[model samples]
Target: MTKHTGAWSGTVAKKSRAAFDGSNLYRRLAVRLDDGTTIDVEVGRALWRELEVGDRLVQDEGGTPHRGQSSTA
Candidate 1:
């Protein structure tokens, strides 16, 4: 068996919608990980506002990291 380890972080590059009735919209959260790999987090439009550029997110062999705010200082 093969185990899937989802590890990456980028930033939000773009966002879009379909009909405007809040039906088929996607919030693409781009992440630039420490390894230099970019990961795109395709979530709902309602949740895109919570993320921004330079926001750090980490995930290792354990599990997904908490979707909380990051510190720069």
Candidate 2:
């Protein structure tokens, strides 16, 4: 299995939806990292509900971090 270690912080740029097997809806987000890199991060329904465009995100191997709250200085 692949392990996602540490964490990556970014902002939610957009949301996407896809239907798999004809009826299963999948949600993903386009995150623009602080380094100017963009990546697609797949998320579950619970986390999806908490996320919105422009919201800051931090994710680790365990999954969504800080319950989707934006990081603080």
Candidate 3:
């Protein structure tokens, strides 16, 4: 798949849920965009480890598409 390029700024709204299946830990992050929209994201364990309640994310847009990582979490 082709990748898009852009970055967004948002605050961590909440930590949704952290789930693990035999092999990996998928973490859910709820972030609030500057406009006040809340979005949830499914992050790989590695990336999730780097995030926290207030830490910011500077991710590649293609890495997580369904969650609209381009503009929010």
lDDT of 3 by residue, 1-73 (tens): 1222444457676775533566755577776766677667666666666666876554445455223243343
Error of 2 at 17 (Å): 1.0
Model 2: CA > 4 A from native: 1-6, 61-73
- Pairs of residues at least 3 apart in sequence or in different chains that clash in candidate 3: none
RMSD per model, one decimal: 5.4, 3.1, 7.1
Which numbered prediction scores highest in lDDT against the true structure?
A: 2
Provide the lDDT at 38 for model 2.
Answer: 84
Query: Which candidate leads in TM-score?
Result: 2
Give candidate 3 regions above 4 Å deviation.
Answer: 1-7, 18-25, 59-73
- Which is the better candidate, 1 or 2, if ranked by lDDT? 2
| lDDT order of candidates, top first | 2, 3, 1
Least accurate 10 contiguous residues by lDDT in model 3: 64-73
Q: Return the lDDT, model 3, position 1.
A: 17
lDDT, model 2, position 2: 32
TM-score per model over all chains: 0.50, 0.73, 0.56
Residue 32 C-alpha lDDT in model 3: 72
